[model samples]
Target: MTSLFAQEIRLSKRHEDIVSQRLMLLQQMENKLGDQNKEKTPQMQRAETALQRNLSLLKDIEAAEKSLQTQNHPVPPPEVASLETLYWASVEEYIPKWEQFLLGRAPYPIGVENPNEAEATIQKEVRQ
Candidate 1:
């Protein structure tokens, strides 16, 4: 039997792609409408056709999603669930080192070179 979890993920990705494509088509149609002539050119005709197809696909995806939701699925065991939790936490913490290098910025533990500034902040906190 096919895994319901995998099927759900695939459907989610497909839905996102179709929605993005639909938005682009809408933008193209809007731009065509904004032109001074407002004539229905071949390009505009194709855009309208594609938009209709995208809408149809979105409807199909929604139907499949509703069917999927009705079915019951087994849950992962505790150890597996804990590991998955840790994995997602790491993903959240990850800041790409390559991106930081390209931006020429200080990496995470942004150092305080001025000891006096650090001391002053501590003293102010102690006073409060």
Candidate 2:
């Protein structure tokens, strides 16, 4: 009976060791993941800031072009009117697309599942 109890105690120690190793590994993984997530936060913020800057610059350019057209054709020149009409049409067509591009994606794509691959692709293009 004593031998049987000793064997059971040994088995329990082995099981405890296995559980301890698993817990240690899990803690290490959590720490690594936390570090990675921290690294990605700043990268995501930069990407978002860049995208906003690009969109703002594009809007500014478009507004300047419209202003120039208005100045050059105070009396509604046919060319200016045509240009204005086309510009607005283009804006109407593109605003939804741009909104979708800006607001529709996961921030990080390197390690996690990214639902915003499309936006990420646009961000990549803008960076290039």
Candidate 3:
């Protein structure tokens, strides 16, 4: 099933698309007005006004989107976040070592400086 957040994202994308179309139209109008050598015409003034309004509206939409995101998916607690970090860290550290073992090569610890401790670890693994 689709999620509410996913639906909202689709809606946001639609709004952004419409905004982009309007922005392009506004730019075209501005360019047409720029080509005129006479004093500012009523059409030029109207185009400038519409452009300003659209810019403000784009800002409002962005602000509203950020507010919705913050309200719906707030930051996780520090402890929960730290636990996730540790889980990924362990996965990153062990996956290659296990892969090497599966391929029939003894996987040595990556950063062991003490030779005796490293030997003992290997011996324990062999005994197991």
Could you tell which candidate, 1 or 3, scores higher by lDDT? 3
Backbone clashes under 3 angstroms, per model = 0, 1, 0
Question: Highest lDDT: which candidate?
Answer: 3
Model 2 error, position 76 (Å): 4.7
Off by over 4 Å in 1: 36-128
Q: Each model's TM-score?
A: 0.27, 0.47, 0.45
* Superposition error at 104 for model 3 (Å): 12
**Sort by lDDT, best first: what order?**
3, 2, 1
lDDT of 2 by residue, 47-105 (tens): 99999999999999999999999898689777777667766765675576566556865
Highest TM-score: give the candidate number.
2
Clashing pairs in 1: none
Model 1 scores a C-alpha lDDT of 0.71
lDDT of 3 by residue, 23-126 (tens): 99999999887866355677788899999999999999999999999999999998778767766765676678667766878755464557787567555544
- lDDT tens digits, residues 1-128, model 1? 36998999999999999999999999998887777346657678889999999999999999998778766545778777776776565445544633575487845433234678656754554444
Return whichever of 1 and 2 wins on TM-score.
2
